[model samples]
Target: MQNQTETYMRRALELAKRGAGHVSPNPMVGCVIVKDGRIIGEGWHEYCGGLHAERNALKNCTEDPAGADLYVTLEPCCHWGRTPPCTDAILEKRIGRVFVGCLDANPLVAGKGAQILRDAGIPVETGICEDECRRLNEVFFHYITNKTPYVVLKYAMTLDGKIAAYTGDSRWVTGEAARRHVHETRAQLSGIMVGVGTVLTDDPLLTCRIEGGRNPYRIICDSHARTPLDCQLIRTAHEIDTVIAVTEWNERAAALKKAGAHLVLCQAKNDKVDLTDLMHQLGAHGLDSILLEGGAELAFAALEAGIVHKVQAYIAPKLIGGAAAKTPLGGTGFAKMADAMPLKNVTVTPLGEDFLIEGVL
Candidate 1:
């Protein structure tokens, strides 16, 4: 029975991923109905303000789901949201048993969903594939629990940790596969951020280019509102959500605002926009997570503020040796090796000629 529960929970997790890029500020939940050791129905949360996974699965069941085992990646919601409570559907279906991947971190539901089923005489088993379920909704969980946005710092560099040549030429630092992967990742997160230097140099559009992929907000860390009015981000600001984090509302800031940019004033740290304040501000705007695609200085400032929760380092196989070459992290680092930040739960994946190393900070 334990093995069967895990099997169904794994399937639920897989289905939940289908909701990526569609659900934000809401968890991507998947549900499966099973009876007599055979699968009967399966569905995932399709979009924000849409029917939940449990309802979709129950509604789509070809046969009667009454007295069947129900497995869901998240605890079926018990409180009213944009849609009706998932617990209502599960109870109405008269499910025999319930298997949950993890209890929702949301205070409105949390453990209440499972308890509601238990109160109704339904046996509910939780914590099946719990870690995977939590990781799947890390952004939502962080935002709901911390009242701030989850931050991921991503950068591409050579094996020697150099992001650019001695002459500051950084074109094609990583292979095409790595770049494509970054674009796909951007689609999942709520926003992508970079420093003014990146805008001034690369003039990147920062929109998700994949067909059918949702575009994330383009956020620039320009303390003085120095983002060029003619840059790609400014040019497309009317089309895509563009935000400029500034320390003051000067003429430059007003000009960018007039040029279709959204401006947020954040406290300055190290004479740059303070990322902690920026995350909280963005969170208030309903952004659950941000992908920090940076120039080294902004990356370093974010890390120093202890706001960067995750890191994705794409390392090219080739070497670019130069003392003057730029590294992925700038600013004055820790005073000693022992003071350096370390990553946990690290993972490495090969991406063509480059490798991706990711971990929680």
Candidate 2:
């Protein structure tokens, strides 16, 4: 049986996920207040520039919390930002003890919040469900510490490692269940990106159709401003946020901007948008995690740029082999086997008629 603190922390993790797609650049945090061996208050950080989980939880307490135990998914923020420091709220509430799932990776609060509580004579216990907490906030950790968004490259391919047939007939490559799973996964990230080739060929809406999942920002890497103005993404740009990264400002730029698509003029190197510069620009947009759902060229570009942190590939059982068939990855792949990218912590699971393979890059 788990201890009360561990159980409370696990519940906090569950609550934290509720803020997904809403809280970006900021980690999802959940808090629970326990009094008399019962949960009296619980809350989560719902959005940016909003009350943090600690303050939200404190606000919901009906009884005095002077001697109550507080369990939080991440360490309480100690520095001031859009809102007051969470540590101050904890002190104001007179929380006696705190159980933290993981230490925040943000330099502003890393180990400092816990120290503040300890100095106030409050008992602070750290590292309860730490791995779960780390995975939950890895995007925020990567963004804050590395100054870049966490990238997950996703694609669907047949058993013979072909993404599309010779005629480029890529529709319905995966089963309905796997497609639904992709939509659900997209709902959790901050944005989805595709190249001009994919936009021209697939014209995907890139919206999350799963229930209770918000649509993420849509990014199109159209170096020459070639994305059709009447495309589904541009047509619906006024409805959801869309970003077009281009190498040169052309006549079509005005139309795209007028269509409510944010234009990012990026310099091209070797006739390709600089992946490093694009990632930095995305960080400026407050995107902590992004899904790479583009064609093989984009996937290879991201992987070669060493920006891909994870890969989620859905493999169907069928084999669509052809000499002109498109593979899942392109570009100059590793010439030597030893130079290939390695994945760790790989997990394979069946999803309907497809198999989902997820691994850390």
lDDT winner among the candidates? 1
lDDT, each prediction: 0.91, 0.90
By how many angstroms RMSD does model 2 differ from the true structure? 2.1
Number of the top-ranking candidate, with TM-score as the measure: 1
Kindly list the per-residue Cα lDDT of model 1 for residues 1-361, writing each as its tens digit: 6777888999999999999989887889999999888899999999998999999999889899989999999999998879898888888888899999999889998899999999999999889999999999988889999988899999999989899999989888999999999988999999999999999988899989888888999999999988999999999999999999999989999999999999999998778888888888999999998999888888988888888999999999989899999998998888999988999989999999789999998
Global local distance difference test of model 2: 0.90
Worst 10 residues of 2 by lDDT: 1-10
TM-score of 1: 0.98
Q: Write the per-residue lDDT of candidate 2 for residues 1-361, one digit (tens) a residue.
A: 2576788999999999888877877899999999988899999999988999989898998888889999999999999899989999899888889999999888888999999999999999999999999989878888899887899999999999988899999887899999998998788888899999998988889999988888989999888889999899999999999999988887898789998899998879789888889999889877888899978888998898889999999999998899889998988888999998989889998999899999998
Q: How many angstroms is residue 333 displaced in model 2 relative to the true structure, after the best TM-score fit?
A: 1.5
